[model samples]
Target: MDQTTLNYIVVGLSFALYFGIAIWARAGSTGEFYAAGRGVHPVLNGMATGADWMSAASFISMAGLIAFTGYDNSTFLMGWTGGYVLLAMLLAPYLRKFGKYTVPEFIGDRFYSTAARVVAVICLIVISVTYVIGQMTGVGVTFARFLEVDVTTGLLIGSAVVFVYAVLGGMKGITYTQVAQYCVLITAYTIPAIFISIALTGNAIPPLGLFGDHTESGLPLLTKLDQVVTDLGFASYTGHHSNTFNMFLFTMSLMIGTAGLPHVIIRFFTVPKVADARWSAGWALVFIALLYLTAPAVGAMARLNIMDTIQTGEVGSPEGNLLYAERPQWIKNWEETGLLSFEDKNGDGRIQFYNDKNADFASKAEEFGWAGNELTVNRDILVLANPEIAQLPGWVIALVAAGGLAAALSTAAGLLLAISSAISHDLVKSVFNPEISEKGELMTARIAMTGAILLATYLGLNPPGFAAQTVALAFGLAAASIFPALMMGIFSKRINSKGAIAGMLVGLVLTVGYVFTYLGMFFIPGTNILPNTPDNWLFGISPASFGTVGAVFNFLAAYVVSMQTEEPPQEIQDLVESVRVPRGAGGATGH
Candidate 1:
């Protein structure tokens, strides 16, 4: 069969499996819809959570980020993964035991304030909407490339598939589908890494192979990579060159942000018990580490591979040249989708694939008769294109398409689930329409999912930033706004409604304003303001890594406001005490 046909069969079958699961495991009620009726097996929930957590961003963008940026991008790896540890330890079980439908529910009920709930709702919507768009963008990109459709058509199709399963199965359907997605995505991700690892480093294990000896250089893979990239203008693969302060802060931000996200926190709610929540988090990490460990390895090796492909031959040999006409099929395929593009910026006949501005190395390459650098590969293509680059079989390539779709869809569904529940259960049912019937509530939730998906689709068509950037925005907002309130509600009893709301608004405004100044989301063009480089940063904090500062502001604001105000009522303090202890937490009732 042709490659495109095979891709279609594999992708179509995978979606069919997801839709089938949605049908078979359809939720019977609002309880099942929102929390899978709190009955998911811990192991399965762990897998689902893994799939949910590792979205299209992790599957598609992370390795590529690590690949091109060298060691500095480790913030993404550290921040994304470290967040889960925070979730497992600081938040997950307690939130799960609190027995709420959404994060806002926990905040409002624990703090005993409708206003607090409204503030939580606004934060949830902001974070969840931004996150959902990223997922939708991923889904569209996967389909546009593999399903051979336009981005718009692909997005509609992808949105429709998620709607089917999400609306039908709700949490129950999504949880199981996510387990399947985890299987598909992990297999798809690792196959290429394993193949390329053996091909480049002669080691079977990709992770160890990263540090293992390279057959060509007889040195560690990272050692060879650092040498090659530096021979060009790139930073060392295993060395650090960015601001340590910002790196540390960025990592902290992603950790708190991850713990704060509504979709991820709600997953813990489905596990059977508090102790199970703890272990389930460990299992989720294990599953997540499968990709996390492999990702950097993939990034380093893929960077090395591209360099080797262009630089492998004798300096003047035609074989040494990266020719536009002689490019690989994967290059052509991705180019067709506009994900992998090169301008031949110098317009030389040959594709110059090197860091030309490496003042020291530029002179040597010029003496060697090379032209200016030309290639500009999109980082998002790294994970998705890895299999094809490694010469993995057709099945493996197909599996990647399936996996990318799985990752994107599962995450989109999860975010939509979070958005819908916050609206239907927390906002509408809990605060606004307290007299609504259970069936009416469920329908409202489904409708809200539909609305959220549509908005996400529109925004996804032209994503405000890269997948990771969008996710970071979601995390940043969650960190600045929701996380502080949730954590204080659990850990402190003095914070009143006024304090929480005011603190959240301040955090939200500061973070959003800073982000907009750099992102150009609010007014003037982002680049016109500053370069976002070390030389231009405020207090050496990169904009990409400034959420930690935003979060600290939140903490300070909440505390200051709380101390100046009346103490929370005795009943609210008692409620806070009840949530902190372990005995009746798993069995607590109502949002």
Candidate 2:
């Protein structure tokens, strides 16, 4: 069968499976809808968490970032992985022990303030909505290429699919659906990595192959990659070229953000017991490691393959460039999606893929009669196109299409759940209508999810950055606003309602203000106060790294405000102590 047909069948079947799971596991009550009735097995919850946690950012964009920027982008890997560890170790069990349906519920009860809960809901909505934009972008990218549709249509289709399963199943349906998605995405990701690894390094394990000698050059894989990219005036694959302070801050932001993310933290609420939550976190790490470990290898190998394709011979040789007329079928297929294109800047009828911005390469490019960089390849396409670039079988390519969709859809469902629950459970039921019926609450949750998906789809069409960068911004927001509040609520007895509210507002406003100043107000085009360049950043901190700084301000503001005011009530202090200790190991209670 043709590749396009195969892609349709594979992606269609995956959608069928997700819809089937949602139907089978349809939530029957508010408890089931919000927390899956707290019955998920630890291992199963871990698998589901893995699918939820490894969104388009991890599956579709991290490696692409690594491939293009080299080691400077490794912060994505370190930050995300380390952040999961921080979440699992420091937050999951305690939050689960507290026995809340949502993060806002926990914050509200812990702080003994309705205002605190409302603020948390706002933060959750903002963080989740921003994060969902990235997932929707991935969805649009995958569908545009595989389904041969425009990005807007693709996003609408993907949104429809998510709406059916997520709104119907709620967390109950999404948890089980995510487990199936985890299977599909992991298989799709690793199979291509293993194939490419063996092809390039003659090793079966991708991570091992990354350090092994390249089959073609007999040099270490990274060493060969460095030589190839440097020959084209790009930075070395293994070199660190970013500011150390920024890298540290970025990593810390991701770590705290992981712990703070409402979708991920809520996953712990699905398991039956505190012990189960811990086990779920551990198992999740294992499942996440499978993909994280393979990502660097995939990035390095994909980069080398791209360079090899463009520079078919020695770099700087006029005859070395690949002829545009003879470009591979993969390039043509991607071009149809508008994510990859070639322009003959020099009218040389050949493609030039190099660092044209490198001034040192200018004279040499003039010597070679090259005008400028002629290939425009979006980083998000690298993984989806990797198998095709390597001439893998039609089925493998189709599987990758399915995997990318699964990764995006799974996380989208999770985030939508967080958004909906924050609205229905935290906002309407808790604040507006204190006596909302269970059925009314469930319907409200589904409606909230639908609205959230619509908003996400609309914003995704005009994303401020690539999938991963947008996600990184979401992480920074969460880190600044949510993580500090949760940490202090659990660890400190003196933090009062006023303190929590003050800290969250400060963190949220500062981070959002800084991000908007550069990324555009509300991420709308032409609204930015300054250019989003390195030189324009504050204290050399990129917007993506400013979350840690925001988090620090959150901590300071809370501490200062709390000491100047009254301490939390005695019962609130006891609640904090109980949440931290394991004496009363009981089942989670619903609000």
Candidate 3:
């Protein structure tokens, strides 16, 4: 059978399972819809959180980024994983003890200000909406590549699937569906890595295989990879080439942003108690690390594999390179998607995949009669094509298609829930219609989900950035606007409502302004005031890294404003103290 047919079968079966689970576990009440009735077990919640947290960026694009950028991109792995430790220790327990349905609800109540809640709802909507664009785009691209449909058709199909589950079951349906998604994605990710590892290094374990000896070269896997890439005029595989200051700040931004994201923070509210929230954070990290640890290894191995395939033998010899006519089926397939291209700049009929701008390597290429590099491989193709590159079985390739969809769908559902809850619970019911009935709220939440899905689908067709880059922006906004407010609410008793509100607005405006100056105004075409490059950046910090500066501004602004404003009410002070202690904490009741 053809590989595409197998992919359709595997992906179809997985979607069937997800849709079935959503139907079986359909939500019945506002409480269940919003917080799963606050009855989820810690481990199961952790698994669900894992699936929710690892979006298309983590599953589909991260390793590819790492593959192309080398050690400089290690920020993604370290920042994303390290933030969980901070989340577990600083944020999760207290938030669970307070027992709120949404992140904005906690912010509003803690500050005792309706205006503060409204600001938070706006921030939550912006961040979640930005994050969902990447997921919806991933769904479109994955279906387009595997299911052989146009991107618009794939997006409609993916959105329909998410709507059936998320709108029907709410958080209750999403949680169980996410558990199954976690299983599918992890299995799909690991099996290919294991096969590739064994193929390259005679080791089944991917992490260990990354450091193990390469079976063909009698050298360590990384050592062989470094040598191969350097020979092709690229930087060494393990070397750091970015400005140190920018790298550090970018890593810190992603870490802070990871902890602050409303979708992730809301996961803690689903668990039964404060203790479960704490334990659940740790378990979520454990599950996340399973893929995280394997990603770098896959990146290193896949890079080596691609270089080896093209070079064939010596880099500067006539008999060494793979001719264009001899390109593999995987190369041909990806070329059809317009993501992989070869120009043959030297017109030698044989592909030359290298960094042509290396002045030091120019003489060597001239001797080999090569003009410039010819092959252009999109980073997102590495993982999806890895199994084929390694000549793995057809089933493994099918599993990869299903896995990417699972990761994207699970995260989209979680973000939509956060958006819908913010609209219904925090904005509409709290402020506009306090007398709204439970049934009415439920109907509104589903309606909100449907609207959010439509918006996300339209935006997905024209994403502001690639999968991972767009996600990083979402994290930056979350860090600047939401995280500082939450930490101050729990840790400081003097942060007044006015101070909190001012800080969030300042952070949100500054971070977004800096981002739009380079990424285009509201991400529309022909609207950017400046080019997005390191030389033009302030102190060489990318817009994505500006979140760190924005967050610092939030902290200082809030503190300065609090000093000039009236202190919070004594009763609000006592509520802060009550949430800090874990004793006497019961199941979260209504707001």
Q: Which ten residues in a row have the lowest lDDT in candidate 1?
A: 582-591
Summarize candidate 2's per-residue lDDT along 331-424 as a digit string, tens digits. Answer: 9999999999898999989999999999998888888888999999999999999999999999999999999999999999999999999999
Report clash pairs, candidate 2. Answer: 83-255
Residue 589 in model 1: lDDT = 29
User: Who wins the TM-score comparison?
Assistant: 2
Error of 1 at 441 (Å): 1.0
Better of 1 and 3 by lDDT: 3
For residues 395-469, what per-residue lDDT tens digits would candidate 1 score against the true structure?
888888999899998999999999999999988998889999999999999999999888888888888656776
TM-score of each: 0.95, 0.99, 0.98
Off by over 4 Å in 1: 314-319, 345-348, 357-371, 522-534, 584-591
CA lDDT scores, all candidates in order: 0.84, 0.93, 0.91
